[model samples]
Target: MSNQLDLFHVQRAYSLAQGPLSNDQLYQSVAEAAGLASDALNQRCEIGRAKAKRSPLKRKIRWYQQTLKAMGVLRKVEGRRGVWELAEPTDKGLHQAPGRVCLLAYSTRLGVAIWGDNNAVFSHLDEPIHLCVTSPPYPLRIQRRYGNVAEHEWVDFITQSLEPIVKQLAPGGSVVLNVSNDIFEVKKPSRSLYIERMVLALHDRLGLSLMDRWPWVNLSKPPGPTHWACVNRQQLCVGWEPVFWFTNDPLKVRSDNRRVLEPHTDRHRRLLEQGGDTRVTHYGDGAHRLRGNGFDTPTDGRIPKNVMIKGHRCSDSLRARAAAKRLGLPAHPAMFPTALAEFAIRFLTREGDLVVDLFSGVNKTGMAAERHGRRWIASEIILQYIKTQAELFSQFEGFWLNPALAVDSPDRTGS
Candidate 1:
């Protein structure tokens, strides 16, 4: 049922490699680790694609290599263009090379993939990422364990953060940012223009183009019961947030509508069967143009609209609660739902593409990527958030996992 590929496995293989390897050598290592023949990677190359002239296998490996080189793990072997060698993970597993700083989490599930800090990590990536699905901690009203900038400065903070990210995108790659607007002035509930300001800054200052704006409709959202909604009743409860899609070049964005089509409505089926609804009606309030309530059916499911409805309940699962209890960790109160991450990933990227999430709390994006077969590089400042969630995605962990991998396990919470 999942329309995903094994991208996670490929990246994991690269991470676990003992030392620097040529592109062919890297693919063979990943393939062997994945329980496939060394030549199994050829299947990806056999299929031609509109976007990439190179084989998917080679492109995927190039991404892996760039990630390694950018992270200061690989370098051209003294003068060879194609040959490379490892420059990091000195026995201690901390990546202390020049131009890159920060100790790696050394996770088993895709070992050596979980990193920290975009400031230290992004500069190390030499290739453009295919997609980036992230739920950035925007300016919010409530205090959180994961910090955010003050409301007044949030727009600038978001814009500045994205500057590096934009440079990391592949030519046809896109970014889907999940951000919620806050009530900056409770006195003037609707006056929070920071989201708008952030959007403008991304476009005007950063030279990024807005591809589309999606409205995430969470039906199971809890009521805020704020002064305006519950007390004065001046505004309705805001149950939706914007998921903005951006790209370096809007004219050539990589998207597959067939990958994320919605089921056709009964009305659509019946109308096409009856060969009816050809009549036109007034279009909205203007009453100038005309349209029909129903029309011919789509061959498959209907093309999805920008308004995506998800009923994922906001409750801790028994497994999550139990893990939190056993590990002495608290569940992440503010985390992106797996379903939300799944939809964005399915819509924007293909199998074998490299996806990155800088804030990677609990790595919902990583989970989605694993299911869909995309390699992901997820990083979080807090090591425990990455550790506690590892159990949920155990298949991707390293083979010779460290016994002390749980060293950061105690008293860890807030994924």
Candidate 2:
């Protein structure tokens, strides 16, 4: 058989084996999947006059299996003779080879979920990323079940996490980071300046330029910081978080505001119909000027402001949480709204571009990218979270779970 056909048979063998399979079973599974006749599959190869002949197809399968193992795709079962299985996750990353990432799951033609540490996975990325968007764990006063660094160590932690990833970004790619604004100093009322430090660190370390600072106002957020805001009367309720946008090259940043435009409000529509203001208007002692026909022309939609007024209780997160509950799994602690991810994705990238999220909680970026016809790659350390994300993504049209990574059944862990 040709090398390409041999490779196809080998891949089929790997995919068909759900658990540890013996050599004979693997060969039979591959033969069945590829519709190969037993005679063709069992063709013998001559070695020496005194030795027994071996099947060439089986030898090729073994060779390809070793190659896949070198690429971190398969593993040999310990204490079991001639048995093999798909590689499992380890604390250091996937267990086979160094500098190779394992795919946890993937859609038919849209995206993939990488199973491992973000830093380890980022270092092995071979393709350029167009958009890198994520809401990493917040640097809180108290740590949550999902890992988060201390307030004082946040800048360093984030810098280390993003440096390698940014190095693989396309020339004009953008990185949108959502950071909490409620992180306060230890035993003090003053807030930490980690966001500002992060901006400067990325700029100095990764040569990225700050594009804009968008404030995401969660309208449905309840009052928090109870001690300072409600009891001490020292701080006001913080209902907004800062989202920083950075680019590899400021002059050529890949962005189009028109893609994320919102529908015109009633007042704005009326103003357009009325042919704008009749008289020239000036504010701040003529410093700001408004022309009479400025609003006369109609448009498809209005350009959105930097202040995004979105509710925290988005339907996507709600539905995902309910699904987790139904499956007897713990709900994700912090799931950013899919709308927010969609806004950034549409504004920053065109269809078919690659969007990446290293700290994916529920893989919202993947969902948003899939909805908009963009390719995506999401990496998360926690197995349960990635499994939950896979369940949600399976509902997408044309979704295809990677058979090689589906052997290990999911165990309920804190989300």
Candidate 3:
């Protein structure tokens, strides 16, 4: 239960190996030292019968690994299984005097892909794109200069935009579209049904299949619908949106669910150690549902629920906002959480894979793509948005990037 020596143990294991360890070797060694099965070491046992919860030890190891990796203490690589090795330290210049160093200046070789129009960008990209993750402007009561279509025209607009995009997908690639329903009509409290309509349109008209849907929740968000939510308290505040995953072939999409596994709670560890649920219970979604045998405490970690809880990084974005103001630019009003892009990227694409964003406002997708070692090309119509985003990226150097250059808009005259 104590995390007193997890780092020490992990570091010692790596020290003994003196080289990268495959997931099997590293996990088995750790488990043997701890007097547990290799798979059990990764198990998250439940703590109680009544409440459904699990342990965090297995998850803690991963968290520590990630933290150490982030701090340059270790490195993790992807392949048949994870490959991890102790990393040598190099000066990141963090301690250097202010304004003396900038990371982006050194990482510019990775190349930055920027375009002003989606159609033009797609036409320009002949290479296959492994994934397309974007949070396009949605139908709303007031038009944002960033270009949201009217409610009635939204589906057609999206269908037309995606026609070229889907063609660029590499075999088994995916598209994750982040969208929310519009509540413009006060009487239609349940929302304007635009989101559902769009999903149907994507399938019926565009030949895209709805693979999965994630409910993205923002806990500390602004209240919605002044009439029903704030004043009357007749409806709960709107706090979630849907991120729809689509692919041409639902049966075969480039997905590695293991990458997005979540940490289990304290209770799950207990159950995992026992190698069985506290009591026999069936998990749903198929006929082969059994609770005791291979069904408990999977070593791959627990699949995250369909609900995604992510908050906008307010502090980080606020700094960007101030910088935008100083530069005489407006911060994007409807930017999705960075994790939205990150989740889709890790879930669907591998390292060095290409990800394209058709409506990449402010380069949130660009930032996430860079973090995951994935190549990225993003298109945004607004020049100021691209300029401000490029300015922000110019300060950091965790990933390789070329300077973002502007391209003449192919449809510059359209709304």
Candidate 4:
């Protein structure tokens, strides 16, 4: 097959140098074309096959040839056989210099690559991303500082800077913003209401529709003192972070399958254990069996509700520091758990779909995409962070490493 293809290319090149040929001329003059037995060609092309492989290479070649013919690169007459011809080079940007960043695509393996800055990413993407999951830096003066921009400034960044990238997204693509309200102890008022209003402003101003809110319930302790001594001491602060899901086109955003499942609660379990009493007779045998066993059987996999528990913390904490030392990389502050990213990716995208994260903090989303066998593009603003993340990622052969690091490794504990 290789030899045949080589001969075909050689013959075609030579024929083009000479002149275009008729069907008979092509078949007679071209070495491989002349050598290709009609019966064999028909069999290889699957012209007479009852059942053909879906998206076969031979069919792809035929389609390519047809497209070339349509574009006047090949000569094909109605009721006549097709003849190949070289396409004339156009003086358009087709001959212009290629972009700096180039992506090498694959069919099987997930595409994982990191871009350092916004400039590096905007022009290099081959396919528009279907889903983008990110949590941008809040207005809080935290461990690290990207900028000290005010609320209005951040809103402008979303509308002016990020909106362009959002426009590049596919018609049905979605953006999930996992931002939290800023708590200013000095002010003594929650900034959540202001942030929520800003989010609404962005949606309305940018023409993006709000799909839903995913509440991230934080089980961690709150900082600073409260008015009441008891309230301050035993404050079971139920911190809820808002995750706003937005879409450029609502119709295009389909349900994601990776939505979190509600585990059976203790009350539900107790009811199931007792089953229905003599007064209450279960209709279905399966229902009765489930009730008798004290287990709540799951219904269909539906879209996940707004509220979600903070199953794992982001990469910046002490836990992440330990994991990073064990894994041999610098800990990232904004890394979302792979589980969360996986859930969102599974629900929002099909197999082989592209996922993009503009604020690629720690590359968690990219790692998740790789684990789930989906392609992803990640862009981080900070160069140091990009280098750190790349080095960390390069250590692993796959998405996750084996023998997961202990929560309290000595090196991590020291940090």
- lDDT of each model, Cα atoms only? 0.65, 0.77, 0.66, 0.53
Better of 3 and 4 by lDDT: 3
Index of the highest-TM-score prediction: 2
Candidates sorted by lDDT, descending order?
2, 3, 1, 4
Least well predicted 10-residue stretch by lDDT in candidate 2: 89-98
lDDT of 2 by residue, 1-415 (tens): 4122333355446555557878888778776765678776678878558567887767766776665575565678899988887665333221222244545555647888876678887887899899999998888866656667887788888888888779888888999999998887777778888888888999998888999999999867778788789888899888888899999998888899999888999998898889866668889989878777677778989898888788887888987887667544568888889999999999999999999999987899999999999999888866557656876887677777554333222332222
In Å, residue 104's CA in model 3 sits off its true spot by 17
Question: Once superposed on the true structure, which residue ranges of model 3 sit more than 4 Å away at CA?
Answer: 1-111, 186-190, 232-234, 278-298, 314-316, 396-415
Q: List the residue pairs that clash in candidate 2.
A: none
Write the number of the candidate with greater TM-score, choosing between 3 and 4.
Answer: 3
- My TM-score estimates for the predictions, one after another, are 0.67, 0.74, 0.65, 0.55
Better of 2 and 3 by TM-score: 2
Candidate 1 colliding pairs, count = 13
Error of 2 at 186 (Å): 1.3
Error of 2 at 203 (Å): 0.7
lDDT of 4: 0.53
Cand. 2 TM to true fold: 0.74
Expressed as tens digits, the lDDT of each residue in 1-415 for candidate 1 is: 0011132333344447755566777767766654655454665434455544445655655665565566555666766658776654333222223344443554433323454566566656776788888888877777566666788888777777666777888887888899885455756756587778888888898787888888888867777546778787877887887888888877778888999988878987787778647777665686565455345444777888888787645332344556556655556656767777788788888888878787777777777787787777776755346555665555563523222233233233223
